[model samples]
Target: MDVQSETVPRDARHRVERTRARARYDRDTVHAILDAGMLAHVAFSVGGQPFVIPMLYARDGKTIVLHGSIASRLMDELADGVPACIGVTHLDGLVLARSHFDHSVNYRSVVVFGRARAVLDADEKASALSRFVDALIPGRAAESRAADRTELAATQVLRLAIEDASAKIRSGGVKDNPADLALPYWAGVVPMRTRYAMPQPEADLADAALPASVRRLLAADEAAA
Candidate 1:
């Protein structure tokens, strides 16, 4: 929501661009896709070698913040304003078509290009780190103790000022050759979703408070699926 509509890059694509509706221009749609994803792939180059590392992240309005140990190689370099390409994707289903060529996956993805900066302030870094934890475990942060000085020193946080970004989404059922419609083989989408099971209380725990935030996440996470 922090990104202004005008600040986004041109929505036009090259000749090789995929389906037109596959492209998303609205900011809210892009943010929603990003929010649904729990992880992001950070792509960058060093000494001309391109690399992409998948890591956990949290979005605070406009900026995408990544937290890692100070000793982490990529995070350290990224804090130095390294040019980076970041991608986040969510796979929604598997489309099964009669022909192998028609098989595809339904997904939503976003690619962002920006300059990275290290979070220097103790307060800002701490807050960003908290958001990262909450994104994954909702009430986990509230249930735990705050980071101490030593912990803060050992942590490295980086923020990417997303200047140019684009989101592409693919959904619905399979696309097949018009002539192949007569084929008898089934053709449809196998929907994929994240679900949850009943809470399994920890063995060592007794009477306890299961925070509402955690309860919601427990219901949303379909790890068994």
Candidate 2:
């Protein structure tokens, strides 16, 4: 399969109809959004019923990896090769406009289209799970113990290739009407961000030192802040 970053053919399926100017197809731009995101809302239909569920995901080259309990119906359906739409979003700020109709939000979001397949091979599934753990926090997979046979057997890992995708982004100041500028109402952007608080340890492990992976994550979060 062709990598989404290499070529994302734009058609009615993945087009941004509302605001065409905000649609972006560049490789770096699309990959950057995926890399920054940790959670994705996956939408798929079973029979005639539709479902949208939030799941933790990891971007692995051209595919997104997700795992769940083996007995979960959602996981079973997705593993059966159902067509899925995954969405990831990061809210940059709240756009406040003088007029309520013009109020909007500044965000970076991506919509991906693909069919999911179950990772049945033991080694492949384990590798995918490891990559997922590391994606959340770099080096975490190495710091933690590997899953045992029983644990691995109870989990279902699925991979969705990025067959077609597109990113829509809105940034900068609030877009308010020129006439509304002189109004008494305040119109500006209230910036928003996700930051990590001080780490909390388990009650039994109160004296344990912070792991290398956690220290690195804290340092990165602090630098970004």
Candidate 3:
């Protein structure tokens, strides 16, 4: 693990004001959170009407890759180089405290600010699509059939470089008032996790056996558990 203590330079837009101790501007921290997440809530506007859409995305180094149908309004609008804010979050636990005011949830979240540009080149678009697949399950892209020309043409790909980003995280036990510690209420953290269950194969592919990517995914999940 490459642990970098250097943090991203913060300005008014990317700085954390409230609970500043929970804020993190390190590239490694932000990247880790983005990699762990599968969905991104993208905030943008069209003709002054604001919209926030949930999108599937993959982090490629300093850029985030997104794909959608070419006919999609959001995709078309973003491709024209509009400023956007992308957010990803993971709920880690329920923090129960002696008082309701102190009750909170342990989470890791990131916000990225950038402008997205359309990926026009065929080869670059194809590689971007592959990254999305591999991000979900390592090596799955190579095992699966590649997208055909027509399919690739119909799909729109966009890349948003990480211009400014910040991560906010909360972890560990409850923080209850010292006086409230004597209260009868139980206080602790109930950890939460997202894990993969056994894979269910399609009936048509009966007994075909699982691919190496799936097996590897399951093994990694089990090891983490």
Candidate 4:
């Protein structure tokens, strides 16, 4: 698959049936959800046993990059080109409805289906690692020390092409039946968000200031807020 493509083609596996109205197949929507999420739950099977593990990931174009210890069983299995499913979700808010059965949480989520492959090339592996750090904090890779040969050798990077994917999102106010709305219950949405606190310098650093990358990240967060 060409990872640089514009959009992911949707099929049966990528379809969202439970809440079909919230399904989104556009590339922009899928990419936005993937970019906003920092963690993913990777699911796969080995010897008929299913395994799901949480992992940090970065999206580069149409591929998702993940890394782990070279000796890890999950990494080894994924590097071998096994089929996998990657899921990411971001909680937006809690919806409180007049009826308990009508309560729900607003969220944005994405599911990707693809075959994982090991990134063996030295340059490509290094680039993927850099992307991981930058994804957490923009411009961080250039501000920090580069990974040495020994460290790179101990790590394994895997790339999964975004071939079949879909995003589902639910937003805005509570949905309640007319009869339930007349009850003496409050209904509203409690918004939620993730924020970064002020950076604390290392204990060993006597008076060192925060790095430009970190400062920039904090500034961006504040601006967004």
Candidate 5:
């Protein structure tokens, strides 16, 4: 994987014309945004009507994997190689400005455009499912029991290659106009963050201690903070 590709080719569909200064085409930037995000919005058209659905996703090298029930309309449409757009965003703060027009959010976002197809191979599908679990919490898949044949058969997994992708980021204090700076209104950023709370155990497992995998996840969160 070329994390520092000289340039990511842009097209009309994936180009970021507005706020061009914030556009990032490097693979590293795009991958970082995608990896940090917990949810993604997948958009596609069905019968000429556009639909956007939120999904849990995992990035594998240059591709993204998403899973759902086998009978889902969105999964069925995506598996047919329909063109789709996947977007993930992480809000960092609220940027308050002196004027309403200058107020905005500090965020990192990525948009990927490609055609997705179902993962039909048993081995590939199983590997993708494991990746999905591990992506949420490292080593979690190894701690849990592997999915059985019937469970695998009931799920539909789709993979979309990140052919055309771009990340846009905005940070720092408010960008109020020079004239507005003289105003008496306060202008600054209110930082926001997401953290994991203490885990609740099942009532039946009162004797069982917290799993090492979960402890590791909590430790990682603390270290990050």
Candidate 6:
């Protein structure tokens, strides 16, 4: 929860410094944003070619864990201690402008830079996977199917010790030019959100007791203001 600005990731997109804004500079805010979402884009340069792939991730204190097929080159390289960039963003709104040149979107995004390596400990891997499930649906993993030995052996799990991290957020009304304001054009912020409705159990499944964690998450997201 301590604010440590020194740990903020170095700006990757340095060209648009104006669009970048920093809030509290610490893991408190950073980890909270990460735990709230399920998707992350992990980017890395391999042989002078940069590739980005969106994957599901989970955070456990300072370690961020990712899982994928063992055949993935990106995962393989990362496990070899390759440098990587991890990004997570939450879209909040849209900026509607009179002219096409002034359109934009309001969002909260974070970019992290660090070296990643494979997690070998079985205990650590299980804990990471538990958090991954909890982040998505609270306690579904405990109540549902458990990964068997064969399944765990075939999966590749990677970990990144969070080092340099930075976050930027944009909110409120659209930032239109002062001249454009007087041009009698309609300009404003269109709020955006991720919403979920009541859960419809699987077609094959019967009326069964749902996990408390799943119910809690649905309540939370539904209650989000």
Using Cα atoms with residue i matched to residue i, what is each candidate's TM-score against the true structure? 0.87, 0.95, 0.95, 0.94, 0.95, 0.86
Per-residue lDDT tens digits for candidate 4, residues 41-71, read: 9999998888999999999988999999999
* Cα lDDT computed for each candidate against the true fold: 0.79, 0.88, 0.90, 0.87, 0.89, 0.75
**Worst ten in a row by lDDT for model 2:** 1-10
Residue-by-residue lDDT tens digits, candidate 2, 72-119: 999999989889999999999999999998999999999888999999
Candidate 1, which ten residues in sequence have the lowest lDDT sum? 7-16
- Kindly list the per-residue Cα lDDT of model 5 for residues 38-135, writing each as its tens digit: 69999999999999999999999989999999989778998899999999999999999999999999999999988899998888889999999988
lDDT of 6: 0.75
Best-fitting candidate, measured by lDDT? 3
Give the true-structure RMSD of model 6. Answer: 3.0
Which parts of model 4 are misplaced by more than 4 Å? 1-10
Candidate 3 weakest lDDT stretch, 10 residues: 1-10
Q: Assess the local accuracy of residue 59 in candidate 5 as a C-alpha lDDT between 0 and 100.
A: 96
- List, residue by residue over 1-225, the lDDT tens digit for candidate 3: 111335777688878789999998888899999999889999999999989999999999889999999999779999998989899999999999999999999999999989899998999999999999998898999999888899899999999987889999999999999999889999999999899998989998778989999999999889988
Clashing pairs in 6: 8-165, 9-164, 9-165, 9-166
Q: Show the lowest summed lDDT stretch of 10 residues, model 6.
A: 1-10
Query: Which candidate do you rate higher for TM-score, 2 or 5?
Result: 2
- Residue range 1-225, candidate 6, lDDT tens digits: 111454454454322356435443456667777777889999988899998999998876676888998788778987888888889999988998766677888877776677788877777676677777776777777876666667677788888887666666777777676668777688888898898877787876658766697688778887886
Candidate 3 Cα lDDT to native: 0.90
Give RMSD (Å) of candidate 3 vs. truth: 2.6
